[model samples]
Target: MKQSNRKVSGTLRVWSGVVAATLLAGCGGAEPVHPDEPFPQTQEQAQENVAAAPIVESMDAIALDRTLTSRTRSLIRARLAQGQAQVHQQVPVVSDSGQQLFLNDQGLNGDVTAGDGLFSAIGDVDFVTHQATQDRIREFQARNPQRPLMASTFDNRVRVSTRPLTALSPSVFQPGVPIPIFPAGITFAVKPANSLIITDASVINDPTRTYDPCSNSGNPNGVWTFNHLMREMANTYVSPSVLTEHWLRQWTVNQNINGWTVPARTAMMPYILTPWPRVGGALDLTRSPFKLVAIVNRLDLGGGRGPAGYASGNAGELRFVFAAVDRTSGTCGVRPFLVIFEYGVPHSSCDAVKTWAQRWLELSAPSMVLGSSAYNAALASLTQQVVVRNAAPRKPNGSAINQIRTNEEWLRYPWELREFHLMGSGPSVNRLQGQPTVLTPGDAHNDTPVLRDFINANTPAILANTYTVPTTFPTASTPFLGAFPWIASDTTSFWRATGISVNEARHKFSLNTCSGCHGRETKTGFTHIDEFGTLSPFLATGMSDPSIAYVVQDPVNTSLNREFFEIEMRASKLDSLANQSCLASAFHRRLTSAH
Candidate 1:
């Protein structure tokens, strides 16, 4: 793909003077046109175009535990409501900013600052603090038997990135841009040799030189680590449920690494290599074993950036800031981090067991060692703060403080809304409650104001269905209010799978989801990376005369066109998919041994 063609991040950076006109020809003409594209066509042609998009096999493919979903939703809501009430009662006289109210609201404040004290010691990698963290991890596992620490039994289940590849020799790399250390198809090693940095071009080019994360020997200066077993399962190709390429795409984003500005599709390789907790199999797929995935981003705060691609709120104090110093070299960098929030679910969404499959999805603001004891403890502390503050009665002052209360349930996280996906929808879990009611085709396509209002108004009916596990999900006859299906699909073939129409899918996922930000019109479903031929030259390729200049002028329709072809072409493919039995057997063996 051309450099200019790469999807822009938070801001859209497109080529300067590429005028788009021919591509949008006949859009306003009276002739019947494809609902998605502006191309004028006869009624027969429009019908044929509609049939080209992929279709899901069935409207109701997944089965879910509605009772559990409903209960969980109620529990979460009650706690949130309590928090809201507490805020109002404590701060009767509210300020315009609401910051003071949030900070001073005393209901959820804990007496001990142990978390703060422990965080302060991160720069030193203090042995005492490390032991304390280990102890916490042990306690967390004991309390939640469902999330087992698998890495303890098998040492080869984790991988780490020792240092950024030097071979690319990136120059003209703007320092202002967040530099990505992991490059696509770059070779990595389990351990750093005498020279931690590898610069030889030949060695870098050799595919055999690649290292397995399971073989990591505890590199302290590593960028990140992964739960290799989870990586293996996700990397393995399966029908509809698991796409190895989709798994790869989750980690890859465009970043400038080693001075080279390039796309880093596999940089997040280390995330999959994160070590498993002492417990095992806490995360299970709603569809395939690899269905549940986690991502840990090293919040690039060097250039005054906030957590996960935004400026941090609260003057950066809300972020879990820590300094990682190299013990041997004494080189240090202040790093604040975020990881997918861990929660337990039953086995597969289709056949949920008595044992819940725990998943880490949303980004948690509170910091701790990944998969260590401190993580759950910190999470518990924050969750406690959230629940208690809202539920607590007014302070002695009698003024109500509605700190941390947001009409939207998803916004409650405050820090993770940009990247959170509540649940993976699949046929087996289709009936699982919490899925929102589907909107009619007319409402989905032309009713932008209604969709926006539905998201913002937080009415009783909308609130009941908004963030909670849905009591019912949309089907072919009835589709979701937003373009949610495009987020993650259980289709054997994505986009192409039979289900909703292209026009409805485009609006729900694009416009309704993120207000069409992140270059909304250029996206292929929820994916931000460039793949569909919606760009200038590509859009003109299929024209009656390829020599003519054509580009989808409207970003919205441009996005629709890209998504439409992504399904029709089945262009999403993967490299290789590693099997999971090895890790699964080892995990079970260790659990049995422990028992």
Candidate 2:
């Protein structure tokens, strides 16, 4: 399906002239910079930052260009925004890979001029990696000898994505008062779920796979439960051949030691981590060395046309965003993760799907208590109808279309997908159903697709402040759009020529991928569900921890520089699905606009 190249007029209005100003003003964003103000950075502070760590690179005059991927450009731009807090002083400069140095355009360190769109930084090149990060790469490179770290990485547009996160019903979810996005009586599971902590892995351990995904795990103490759904999806539908150990990673855990036992190190260590023993007794997600936070939600894809067709067999999906608390340490993958369960509602028709979505809205109502039987029944009604088992049809070798065979050998890889069976993003890599094969996270195919080059290319096309979404976009049968649509990594630097774009194309394409949405594509970091006790930016109204001043303006949308609440978009979808008559929205849609 081709994504529309159209722009959101309202967002464009608010976003109109910010990028240009950002290019010159450095980090002030839209704020006016006074002449007398001095930037508050010092050489001493810069040196102090690198005193303990090796200086991988040094730069004096830096000129950001289109050749740089969106994440790199945005990270530099965001660092500049943070410097805007202290106008007139030395502007702080940090590379996308987190190397901080004394950089400015005051012409002191070799900058031509601040107004010339050139920065004077103490870095040699745009890309740099700390020794620690390089060590981790060495770990991966040692095992995967066939995969070249540099060439394969450079060719494949891979980078560490920031992070990600659903269910429901029958006629019981009939629509109620359609008052805005979130109804008065409804309590979104996200709100209450945010408080429900998982200090121990057992909280999410549904060993029997008998618990309902919508309701809490069978355990009375677990308020947020989706382990059973995750187990089933990963073990059964995610791949052609069911894998019972899908949740486990057999990587050697000789990396940073946090929680893995001696035997657990060489054996299959759980990729997902949760703070155990609390050793320090009880600590919040913020203080815990390794913690697991969970978020649950239901999403409506679209109603299909009878059975299955180019745009038929559509069904709403359930999302489970598990934010690995990375505030602490451990490289053996404490990275933020997510898993998606398919067919949350019936696939008979779009209206039937909406009836199920309506049920979720009611279950999510704030008034509904966590453990009450009503909550249990509301969840059961929806989860019971979900279908996790599905097969992929034959596909050809086209850049636009995904090529998966019609056989039963569960996708051999973690992220390989052809249909909506199941999708999951581990710490480093990710791929999802209905997306282009060229966009596959780490697959180094015969040749790079033209669309792939266009996406990651750091060309002037993006500076135009509009994105040209490729018409060749892939869609299995989804019918709606929001953040992380199409159910959307690698470290080898985000310096790929293919990268983040602008406006509609930027959000649509970037948001479709795990990395694009998580890294600068949407002004996010680590996890959309990264917070503990507090609501995540995906649900709460804000960007990912922009604690510093002058958040680089969102080059793509410009509207979400400081605050972007993903929930509003999700809430609006639920409202439309549960409130708007499916008859009106269920009509046939073209491959382009259906999303």
Q: How high is the lDDT of residue 122 in model 2?
A: 29
Candidate 2, residues 48-164: lDDT per residue as tens digits?
A: 321211111111112233332212222122123232324434443333333444444453433334454333442322222212223333554565567433210000111111111
Alpha-carbon TM-score of each model against the true structure: 0.20, 0.38
Model 2 clash tally? 42
Off by over 4 Å in 2: 1-227, 230-242, 246-295, 303-314, 321-344, 364-367, 387-508, 531-535, 542-552, 555-565, 586-595
TM-score, candidate 2, is: 0.38
- Candidate 2 C-alpha RMSD relative to the actual structure: 24.5
Q: In lDDT terms, how accurate is model 1? A: 0.19
Candidate 1 residue spans exceeding 4 A from truth: 1-231, 234-453, 459-515, 521-527, 531-595
Candidate that scores best on TM-score: 2
